[model samples]
Target: MKTRKKILVACGTAIATSTVVARKIEEELEKRGIAVETTQCKASEVPSKAEGHDLIVATTFVSGAGDIPVIQTVSFLTGVGIEADIDRIISYIEGA
Candidate 1:
């Protein structure tokens, strides 16, 4: 069987909108049968929190932190960049 992919979702704050974005990512990933682990954290904490994760996703800009692949995107609520962002994440995880 294929291994499940682990993902980290982080934001500038660990409340409200960040939580919502994390949930949306979890839901979307789960629908595809991909295993995801999400955490809402301050943007500054993302690099540290991303340890052992296959991918790190941030709602805001973050740099020079985790060694894993990272995706920087806006909230999914905007519905503008979500699909492309998600596709990039999945492709990265799938080693595409």
Candidate 2:
């Protein structure tokens, strides 16, 4: 079986906005049959919380994420360039 990709979806509060973005990412990845485990957390927690994550998708800037690929985007909520963002996520999954 293929291993699932671990994703970190972070925002300010890790509630409302992150929830929406995480759901969208889950749906998109599910459609592509790319299994993923998403963890929601505050952007501020990303540095420590992103230890084993394959990717970091955040609604705000997140520094100190080490070598993790951080995609700072709000398009999932704004409905703008969302596909591009998803494509980026897919690329990472594909590369992995």
Candidate 3:
């Protein structure tokens, strides 16, 4: 069996916005048969909370994520270019 992917979903507040992004990522990836675990954090917390995660998805600028792949976008909130973003994330999973 394949291991579940760990995704760190971050935004400015780490509350409402991050929740939305995390939930959407979980829902979308599950439909594609990809198991994922998402943890929400503030962008400022990213450097400290980013370890052990496979990927970082943020709605704002984030750094200190080390070598983990980071996808910075507002697509989830905007409802635009979402498919392309998801595809990009899927590509990372495939490569992993």
Q: What TM-score, to 2 decimals, does candidate 1 have? A: 0.81
Q: What's the lDDT of the predicted structure labeled candidate 1?
A: 0.75
TM-score of each: 0.81, 0.95, 0.96
Residue 23, candidate 1: how far off, in angstroms?
Answer: 1.0
Q: Write the per-residue lDDT of candidate 1 for residues 1-96, one digit (tens) a residue.
A: 776677777677767667888888878877878766676777788766777777777778876554788777774868787778777878988882
Off by over 4 Å in 2: none
Where is model 1 more than 4 Å wrong at Cα?
none
Q: List, residue by residue over 5-84, the lDDT tens digit for candidate 3.
A: 88999999998999999998888888988888899999999999999988999999999999999999999999998899
lDDT of each: 0.75, 0.90, 0.92
Clashing pairs in 2: none
List of clashing residue pairs for candidate 1: none
Instruction: Work out how many backbone clashes candidate 3 has.
Output: 0
Error of 2 at 65 (Å): 0.4
Between which residue pairs do clashes occur in model 3? none
- Residue runs of model 3 more than 4 Å from their true location after superposition: none
Candidate 3 residue 22 C-alpha distance from true site, Å: 0.5
Per-residue error (Å), model 1, residue 6: 1.8
lDDT of 2 by residue, 1-96 (tens): 978899999999998999999999999888977779899999889888989999999999888899889899999999999889989998987786
